[model samples]
Target: MEQDTNQNKVSKADSIRVKLYWRMAVMLLVIIVGILAMLAVIVTQGWSVYKRQSAWALASQKQAVWGLVNDARFKLEEVSNMQTELQVNLDPVFGSYIGAGSDFDQLKDRFGKNKGQFNASLKEIETQIKALRGTNGDFAKLGAAVRRDFNQYDRDTNKLLNAGDSGEDAVPYEQIEQDMVRTKKSLSALKARLDQERKAMGEVKALTIEDMARTLSILVGVIVVVIAALILISMFMIQNFTANMIKPLHESVRHARALAAGDLTRKLNFQPNRIITENSEIGSLCLSLQSMSEHLNAMLRQVDGSTQRVNLTSKEIRTSSR
Candidate 1:
């Protein structure tokens, strides 16, 4: 019976040890999961912030580029409008010079007075044209060629007007027409080119916005997924740990109650499935409990033996007295 009691106590100690290891394992798992979750949250937050900053930077760059393109377009439009006004004024001037007859000198004088204004307008146009040319490579070469032709036409017209005897007949109208046509064609080409550039700038801005948005969205998704996964893992670990700890405690409570009820025949049955690598307070407690149980059982046996001897003595005393 004593051997069985000792075996039961050993079994109970082993069981407590196994439960202790399981509880510790669960706790460690929870801690690891918690750490991983925290790391995921930090990483995801950092990544999201980075993506947003990058997107803002890209947007700023695109805005700057578009601003330049808009400025170029505005300059080109100003030049085109000036050229149209000049063409309108030149038509009547040309007709008057051709039909002036004997009053040609009077007309020529009038033309001379207006010439200053014309020259000023032409200079302004040329300046703006140069600005347009410098803005882009395609516009530069075309604008230079057009300006050269316009200059030649101006020279020819001035020379004809200055000659007193030669009259307006000396003016090469055909050449003027050809130069004007070329100028119009060049202006149209420049306008078209500017429009194309503006369009391209807009498209680039759109693409940049789209790419930035995509990056931000992807980063957000990653962050969410990581956080969710970490949460679930943590919950699972916590639940597992709770079960391990609670089951062992409940069993220990039951065993303790049974022992308290004076059931000396009843003993705790436990199994240790884990090894102890170091001395622990819990290990010492278990060892102490085992020792206490052994001592209690020994004391109980001595009491039983004493009671039997006292009964035997009492019966002998009674027979001698009779």
Candidate 2:
């Protein structure tokens, strides 16, 4: 019966622990989930910020390439106009000079200005191509083609300017015209290539950013699951400690109080499944209380029997004296 009572107390404590710990678990789970959620937000925001910064750098590089392409296109137009102007002046009707010296001098001045501008523009394009070397080899190839054609055009222009002193009619207009045509075609192709490359790069960057976000999302999801598992395990540990350790201590205190109130009929019931072992201090204390109760009850029974015998002896003395 005592063992059964102890088992019942332990069972009741476990039931209460289950109820109380559920409430505690809810509160703790909320706090843990909130913290994990905050961490996920911070990580996501930080990664997004980094992704934006990286994308911005790539965009700036593409913008630089765009600006260089525009500058090259403008320079190419200028060179084509200069070549046409030179061809018009080379005509015997338009360029009938006061002297051969003035004709050579004017041609030299015009060719020098055009050559300097074209060289500067070509150099800038080459530099941009070098910067985009590993990024896009096709761009560099297109840029090289443009440069080659422009160089050929420069040579033809210089030949015409040098040959001008011979006679206006002797200028190689046919060769200059062919070189101009080729240079213009190459420049147009280069512009088209630049536009296509910009669009492709934008698409690639967008896809890369999307992949990174997806990866981060997977990682955060795993972290959240692990954190939730840890929270549940911690809550179980707390419940176990409350049920096994605290409940046993409370039972010991209650038993001690009952003994103090002179309830010797009741025993300090110890169940086999209890956390407090018979070798423990609480176990010894319970043993002492049980021993004290038994000793007090035995002494009370002896005192009552002695009082009954004394009353019987007094009754006999009273009858003899009467």
Model-by-model lDDT, in order?
0.53, 0.66
TM-score of the candidate numbered 2? 0.62
True lDDT of residue 68, candidate 2: 75
Model 2 lDDT per residue over 145-263, tens place: 88888788777666566554555443356777887788778777877877776776676577667766776786687668767876786687667645665655666688778867877
lDDT by residue (tens digit), candidate 1, 52-104: 55555544443443444344444434433443443343434543333335655
lDDT of 1 at 128: 49
User: What does the lDDT read for residue 121 in candidate 2?
Assistant: 75
Model 1 residue 233 distance off true place after TM-score fit, in angstroms: 2.2
**Model 2 clashing residue pairs (backbone):** none
Assess the local accuracy of residue 239 in candidate 1 as a C-alpha lDDT between 0 and 100: 74
